[model samples]
Structure formats: structure tokens, C-alpha cells
Target chain A: MSVVSDRVTALVPSQWWQRSHELLSRVFEDDRRLLALCLTPALALYVLVAILPMVWAFNLSLYEVSTLNPVWEWTGPGRLLDIVASGTFQAAFGRSLVFGFGSVAFQIVVGVSLALLVNREFKGAVLARALALLPYMVPAVAIGMVGQFMLNAQYGIINLVLIRVGILNNPVAFLGLPETAMATVMVVGSWKFAVFVTLLTLARLQSIPENFYEGATMCGANAYQKFRDVTLPRIKNVILIAALLRTLWMFNKFDIIYIMTRGGPGETTTTIPLHAYEVAFNQYRLGEAAGIAALMFVFLALWSIVYFRVARPEEEVRVA
Target chain B: MTDIQVDTLRKEFSSDGGEIVAVDDVSFTVEDGEFVCIVGPSGCGKTTLLRCIAGLEHPTSGEITLGGEAVTDVPPQNRNLAFVFQDITLYPHMKVWENIAYPLKLDGVGADTRYERAQEVADTIQIGELLDKYPGELSGGQQQRVAIGRSIIRSPRAYLLDEPMSDLDAKLKKEMRVELQRIQQQVGGTMVYVTHDQEEAMTLSDRMIVMDDGEIQQFGSPQRVYHEPNNVFVSQFIGSPEINLLPATCRDGATVAVDDTDWRVDTGVDADSVPESVTLGFRPRHTTVERTADPDGIGGEVALVEAVGDENILYIDSEVGELRAVADIEQNPIEEGDSVAIGVERAYLFDAETGETVATSRRHGDRSEDQVEA
Candidate 1:
């Protein structure tokens, strides 16, 4: 199909698409109109599949609907407002703030340390770095299964080990109680996502020249001084972008928490995404679920905009 | 003021599991308030020697003394010295003021004092208006100035610069050479500069060390090193439009026969030390070319003529080999395929096998090493 489109574009020599071509050529050079023409099929497919479903869901949010029986009652945004005022959403929203920020903070701390460790040329450094990427590469379901196995109340490895170590009298119902459930899920979420931040920070670390460290040494900066003066300021932007991305991802993340605690013994671990999923699938409240998802989209968009405005690099962005 | 004395310094680096010696047994002294340049072709241990003195690289087996105190075990930070790297090492995240204030900051200076010193240095470098801009925002030349500013912000015992102006364009490099010399004189501190370009070395240094193959070829004032090169390597490495070499046999104490023509050679050497065949070395400026061949002159055919602003270098294929001779274009008019007679006005005679200097011209004034200072 691409070959056919290429041939067709080559056969047609017209100036009708000049304006849009000029606009695209400003972004990236050469073959602007034909490249845009080639992108049409993928754009159409996305509109049909991903985009159309989101638009349809947004449309459905203004009406009362049920999936169990084919009934659509005209509600005029009343159902959406009702969900917004509901106590379940309020509790879930509070829990999500704890989980999203909490997990993102954990990921940032762990990822930066890991990146710093692996950036040096130590023996077995490559193997150590590759091993650090395991959690991110493993399937979320497998991770959840491992978490369940280790945290089982009756006869789990964690309980047995804690008893032997004498740090805890027992395992203390790790994934089974309201107090520990969210924390447990956050641990699992952070472990899975931290490697991505490490990758980003590591790439940035590699680009920083060796001369900066040498310069600092010649200037009489000790090890700690060098890290504080040279290394930290250089990677500050990467760290900020990494933290922001992790926050965004952690907010929308559902599978790890859902399978690990299933939104917990109470709904203590029910973040906004998990709450929307439970509403749509468990209670068959399609309209309410769509409304919750739409709220999440708007909140994330606003947060991203505010975060960027506060933390964006002050220099004009140039292609590296 | 401090003087640096490096004694038989050696450095070996392992590459791909095999050890290679970078700096061989080398020794030299940089006198206080003097500017010394270590000049050589790339990979000739000039940079390595500078680094060892700066305490950036540890010598395999040797000693370096600053102000008569041995610093073999000192780390870079503990050593009272500053080194400017070849590539600009300005902190990209730092503004020019912060970059220049870095060495003072290491000494735990107060913020007010640090800024004061940084401003003074910036004004000295004529970069006062650029203090607030980040290093990344500055041009390459400006960044280099900031790097140099950082080095000089604190008064170290000596300054070691590793080709700091190598990355600039040619015009900027020429300008900075004179500026660096002026700065050196103003500060009156010992400075050890390393560069691969002989032109920069001769222009900027009070004394120059010509090095090759991890060893010092000659160390003296730029004029002495240029005029009385100790060996063939020094002779060839220190000059532009490279000096010509013709195989000759010593006939007596003052005359050498070159291609059946006798040229006068003066030296302090007794006739007993003179060898039979001496490889003759003479600068291009001393070779005179005439359009007609004579019995007393060496004849050659003109190969190529290169006009370089004020002078022309004629590459002539003569009986000995190809010889490069500097000519005034207006005075000595010749072109390709023109047969010319080459007259030798001045020359040095080195033993053919050992390449050690056997004779030199009386034009060099005196053969004593101290003549470099005179």
C-alpha cells in the first residue's frame, strides 16, 4: 500500500497541497505533502479504533446507560455530576493521590540511585544493569502472582522469613488488610516502573562529558563536592522529566494494583483508574465509568501543563 | 614564584590488555615567572607530561617538585596548581560567573568574595558582559575564555594549559596567542603550556621543549631551539617550510663536500671528533638559487613553486634529493622545469649514522646553552 501511494504521489504533480506542505515542512524537511499523505491511513485507523471509542465514551458520559440490559435513559449530565459527588469517588480520589505520588516518589529515589550506580565502569556493571531491568520487563500478571505467593497469610515465604528473622512476629496480613494493602501495591508498582526512569536518567548521564568531572577535580572539588556541584545540576532536567512521566504513568496504572490486591480487602487501594474499571465491569455502570475516566483525563492534562510551566528548561529547545 | 622540576618521569597506559608507554624517561625544569611550552606532534607525550605535572596522571616512576617540594603522591585537588583542558570544560549548567568562581568556591570563599574575584577575572579577559550567561549559551571561543578564567581565578603555584585554544578557528587562535603571552607577563607566574603546533610554541613561549616519541628532543629558548637544534629531529620539527638535508662528507674542520661542491662549516669540535660523512642541515632561508648552473654550485630542477603571502618556497629536485628553498618571488623568478644552481650560505653538519650535531655556523653567535638566555 505504501509503494502504491508513493507511485501515485509521484504521478501527481500539483501545487494544491502547498500550504499544508509548507506547514509540515517547517516541522521536518522534505517530501512534506507526500509524507502527510502517507500518514493518512494510520490516522484513519487510529480515528476508527482508539480515538472513536474515546469520543463515544465521552458522549455516553452525559446519558444514563447499562450494559446488562439495553437501556439508555436520557440524563442530561446528571449521572456525571452524581458520580463526581459520590463518596466512593471521593475516597478513591484521595487514595489515588497517595498511591500516584507515593509510587512516583519511590520510583524516582530508587531509579536515580540505580542509574548513578550503573553509570560507572565497574566490573560486572553490564550484568548488574541488565538485572536491574528485570522488574520492568516481567509481565505485570506474573509480578502480581509472585506478590500473592509471597504475601499469603497462612504459609508464605515472607511470613516464614520474618518469623525466622524476628523483625516481625508474623507477616501481618501484607496484602489482606486495609492499612497495608495500598502500601504493598505501591511497592509492586514502583518496582515495576522504576527501571524506565533509570533508562532515561542513564541515557542523560552518558551524554555528560568526562571533562566536567576532570574540570571539577582540577578545581579542587572532592568527591561529594563534585557530585553536588557538577553531576546534580547537569542531570536536574532529566530527573524532573523522569519524575513527571512516572507520575503520569502511575496515575493511570491499574493492572499491577488490580491483580496484586484487587483494589484490596476494603476499597483502600482503589485508585481512579481501578475505580472506573470496577464501576464499568463489576457494577455495570457504563455512564459513571466514562464520566470518571473523562475526569481523570482532564486532571492529568491540567497537571502536566502546570508541571511543565513550572519546571521547563529556560533555554530555547534545540535538536540535540 | 615557583619552579617545577620533573625528574625522569615515565607513564605507561594499558590499552586492550597490552601496556604501552606514553611518556618515557623525560626531565625538564620550568623556571619561576617563565613561560615554557612543550611542543611536539600529536601523541608525542607532551600532554601526558603536562598531566603528570598537574597531578592528573600518576607517573610510572619519577618525581615532580613544585617550589622544591616533592609532589609525586599528591592528588590533583591537593596540588596547588590549575590545569586548563584542551577541550573547553566550562560547566554547562553554570553561568560564566559561577564557572570562574569554582576554584575559589573550592577554597570555601564567601559568596561576595567569589563574585568579586570572578568579576575581576571576567573584566581581565574582556568578558565582563557575559558573566550571567550559561556556558552552553556562549560561543566556543567565549567558553574557552571562561575555562581559562576559571584556571586563573585562584593563584596557584603554576598554570598548566593543555592546548586550550586548539578548538578555535585559525584567526582566533592567532589573536589568543599574543593575549595569553600578555596575560602571562602581567601575572608573572610559572606557566607550562603544551601544543602540537610549532608556530604557537615559538610565538607564545619564553622557552620551548621540542619532544617526539615520548622523549625530549631539545629544550631551550625558541630562538636557540630554532637556530641550534641539538639533533635532526629538533631541526626538522621546529621549522616551517622544513629545513633541507643533503648528504655530505667532511673534508676538513671548516669545509664539507656536498655533491662535489665544498661548503664552509664552523664548529668548536676538534678535527678528531669529525666523521667522514655528515648529513648536512640548513634552513630554507640560507639556500640561494640562480638560474644558471656553475661548477661551484649544486644544480637542481625546479619541481614546484608555492607563493605564501610574503615569500615563495621552491621545491627543487637536486642531486642529493628534493630540497625546499625560500625565495623572494620578485628577486628569484623561476617556474616548474627551470634548472637552477643552489648556493649554501649556512648549514649544520650532523653525523650521518648517529644524527648528532658535528658542526654549526658561526652566525649562531655562541654554542653555549646559556646563550639561549643571552
Candidate 2:
């Protein structure tokens, strides 16, 4: 290992390395130039990937274009207005709200609970924490498949167990029924992402000192009171930030829902992402699909700005 | 207000090496409204004992009682004790008033009433203007005052402070020590304070418990612990600048032969009655020094002259070891490398094997060791 490390070190030219170090130090000596040098790559990448694509989509939204026709016709903002006023678009937006809110709520509740549970000291606490994060590491395709198998009407363990325990007289076709399809897909879509919340909440929870609880105890606070006074305040900002990210991801979520229900038992789980996919691919009207995508981008950007302005989660870091 | 009685408390913590006894069969009492300071070196179980009394740490065996009620089984919250942690754990998110009135809020007090009470408590602790600011916005001393305000808000049965001012600078520590004493007097509550600083323990405590190795060496008033130390450890640990110890052995005619020197310590008692092997302890203040070339007296060269306030403490490098002797800075006019003769005006004779004080001199140049024994 020592010989290999020495050889690795020897691979770099000594004078060239010294020259580069000197050059870097000289460049970093100027604050404005250093700031520009540090930020340029990230800024360039963001513009290329995110900003350019969004601008292209917005420009595409102004024209009536189709893959089938190989022709573009200038239709202006009338096409965007028509897409927005359509019943299909309105229904998809409502479903997006339901799935987004439901998944975020479920994730926060389960994630914070899991974080609290695994934060304790026990015999196999390290193993338990690792196991709790295992779901998040699993691929989205595998999550959808496993979710489908578990919720199967015929041989699914869930229906069988519920029927065996006599809670249901019949095995319910969870995905086949429009009433349960959206709810089921929302849960499955949120399963892996909930661990993301757990990871953030746990990191924040661990940073809270043990003396805070002891101080609370000395202040005559009971178990519930301690949680409200000490634990909740410390973890509040992390939970809020997690919920914001989860809501954004859930709003634009497509893969797991597509894999499981494929826009539903008759459009039940068809969120904004699924609607845009169907409009772009199935209908082959690229302009309208781009219009829908552009609307989503604007909505999410506005929502993020509003959420940050209202919540002020940054105050926690300042106070801490 | 309640007196805390800890009876034969023993706390053992298991580590890879084995069981470590943190508090070893210790027992003491803090009378109602009295401030008792438990003083010790680090890891001496002083903090553990205070936590045990507050019911934060469960004892492996024995009991603690508050106002004649056993609280060993009770949780810390139910014990109604206010604890100021050594680290000064003020809630960072809460404003000063909210942190102060958290206990009242927990007790189902309304916001308006609790805020009013918090403001009053904050004012009493000299943090009235900081009520609207968060803990992170305050300095270390202000944060400590907020922590103290939180503890004193509800007037718990007793206050347990574990080196609350240890994190402050020397100037801030002195200021807070006086502020804490004033608050204790104003509240008139029983307090069990733990600190490693001997000066803090001496000045702030009604009675101080000097501990080492999970056991109390002596427990008494500061003056008593200073002048009448129960053992060598207490004598060395209690006094600032530390007490100097020299090895000596009993000789003929009520005298003890000092180490490798012709100097003799008159025990003021029968020489045969004194232990054959003994240790002599004398504080720097009790020790006297003179410029002399006499071979019969203890001789040393002053290595360092430390001028502290009105007195100059001379660190003498002698034949036996380094000895400390204090003198009036103006009168002594001492300098480094100056040869001086050292004398013990009042000294303590400790048993060499056990480190227990055998006898103590009663007065200046009046060595009546037998008088102390009687």
C-alpha cells in the first residue's frame, strides 16, 4: 500500500504541481475573481441543463408543432390558454394536488417517527438505522414492482391478511378501483422518498444536545412536554425543508405511478408529469406538451418562493 | 424549600475495562436554604453526586431524600429540582423570556401570565433587556444568566448547579459568582453547586465538600477546611497556591528531623509519642521566610516571585523540593535567585503512611500539637 501510494504520488510532475498550486493561490488572492472562478462552472451547468431546456419549452409552447406533421405553425398564447381550460388538464392538476399533499403528509409523519425511533441507543441501534434507510436505496422500478405485488387483488399478502383477519369480506382490486388507485400509488410513490425525510430529520435530531432534554427534565417537563419544548423546536426547520422538497418531487413524480397504474383506473393517479408525458408522446403535440411542462415549471418556482418567504426555515440555522 | 439528604449513594458505570465507581458510598446533607458546594478535581464524582441528588442519574444503590421524602425512585421532573448544567444549556431557539418561563409553560400556565413571570425572573437575574433576544444572540455570561433565570423562575425545591460559570473568563466568572450568591440569597433556596475551582468553592459556599477519587476527604466551612484540614489531600486541594509538604521523621526531645537538614520541628509534645515517619504541611501564607546563611534552618533560592495583589509568593527551590512562601510585597522586597531561610510558623504533622493529619500547630510559633489532640 505504501509503495503504491508512493508511486501514485510520483506520477504527478513535482514542478507542474508547484506551478499549479502557485497559480491557484495567486488567482484566489483576489476575492471577486475567486468568487467568479468558483461559481462559473456550476452556473454554466445550471444554465445549460435547467434554464436552456425551460426556455426552449416556453418557446415551443408559443407554436403549434407536432412530431407527426413535421411542421410548425405559430398559434401564440391561445393554445396554452386552451390547454389550461381543458377538463383533462384541470382533473390532472387536482389529482396532482391530492397526491402531492398526501405523500408529503405521509412522509413527514412516518419519517419523523422513524428518525425518533432509530435515534435512541439500543443493542442493535446501528443496524436498525441502516435497515431503516434501506428503502431509500432501492430503485424506483423495484419499488413499483414490489408495491404492485403486495397490493395484488388475487395473491397479494395485504388482501389475504386483511381478509384472513376478517376486516374485508372480499379481496379488493386496489389499483383497478379508481377510488383506491390514487391513494395506493401515492403511498408507493412516497415509500422510498420518505426515507429522504428520515435521513434529514435524523441528522438534525442528532445535532440536538442531550443536555437540552436534561434541562427540560430539570424544568419539570414531562415526556410529551419535553418533546414539544425541546425536540420539536430543534427538528422543526429540517422537517419543513424536507416537506418542501418532498412536495416538489411528489408533484413532478412520474415513474412509480406510471409503472404501477399508468395514469390509472381511468385517470385517477394522472398527475401533472403523467399528463405532460401523455400529451407529448401519445398525442404527439409537442407544443401543447411543452406548454404543460412550462406551466409546471412556473408553478413550482412560484410555490418554492412562496413557501420560503412564508416559512423562513433559514432562521433556525441563524439561531442555532 | 427543602433540605436534600443523600444516604449511602453508590453509582457504578460499566466500561470496557470494568465497572467504574463514580460515586462511592457517599452521603451528605444540604440544609434548607443553605448553599453547599461540592469541590473536587475532574472525574472525582462531584457532578455525578449532584446529578444523583437531582434524580437525573440513578444510583446503583442507596437513597436520596428531599424534605424527608425519598426521591430515589422519582424521576428528575417529579423531584422538582432546577439544574444549571456546566455547559449552560439555554434553549437556542427560544427567546430569553420563553426559556426562563418554560417551566411555567409546561405547568399549563397561559402565555400572558407566563410571559409576565418570565420578565420578572429575567429582571431579577439582570437579563431584563435580553428577554426578547435568543440565546445565540447573547454573550456567554448573558447565556449563563438566562440559564440561571430559567432555573430560578419556578423556585424549585433546590438548585443544582454543576460548574455553571466554569465556561466564563476570569473576570466574568468573578462577576457571576457574586451575582449567583446574591440570587441565592434573594431566592433563599437550598443549592448544591459543584465546581473544580477551589476559590469558587471557598467564596460561594456556606460549606464545601472536598472530594477525591469518589470519596469526600473533608466537609466543613471554608475557614475550617482551610485552617483545620482533615487530611493531607484536603489541605493540598483546598488552599490556593497549594500547601507545601515535606518529608520528616521524629527525633529526640519533642522534635522532628526535617528531610536531610539540621532543622528540627518542635512537635510541642513527647518525641516518643510522635510517629517515627511523618509529613509536614504548611500553606504559603503560614510559612515565614528570612534572608539568612544559617545552616540549621531550611535554606532555598527563590526561583520565582509571583506578585498577587498585596502579597508576593516566593517559589523557593530548596534541597528537599520546591516550597512556596508568601510575604507582603512591599515589606519582603524579594527577588529571584535570592537565598532565603524558610520557617513554618504554623504547620500540620500528617502520618506518612496514611496521609492523615496527626496534629496541627495552634498558633504562630506556639507549637502545641498535644493541645489539638486533646
Winning candidate number (TM-score): 2
Per-candidate TM equals 0.89, 0.94
Colliding pairs, model 2: none
Q: For model 1, what TM-score is found for chain B?
A: 0.91
lDDT digits (tens) for residues A1-320 of candidate 2: 99998898799988988999999888989899899998999999999999999899999999988887877899998888898899999999999999999999999999999999999989899999999999998999999998899999999999999999999999999999988998889888887888999999999988888888898899988888889878898899899999999999989998999999999888888999999999899989899999999888888999999999999776665453
Mark the 10 consecutive residues where model 2 chain B has the least summed lDDT: B365-374
Q: Each predicted complex: what DockQ?
A: 0.39, 0.63
TM-score of 1: 0.89
Candidate 1 lDDT over residue span B135-198, tens digit each: 8788878888888889888888999999998889999998788778877877778999999999
lDDT of 2 at A206: 89
Ten contiguous residues minimizing lDDT sum, candidate 1 chain A: A311-320
Q: What C-alpha lDDT does candidate 1 achieve relative to the native structure?
A: 0.84
In order, what lDDT does every prediction score?
0.84, 0.88
Displacement of residue A269 (Cα, Å) in model 1 is: 1.3
Can you list the residue pairs that collide in candidate 1?
none
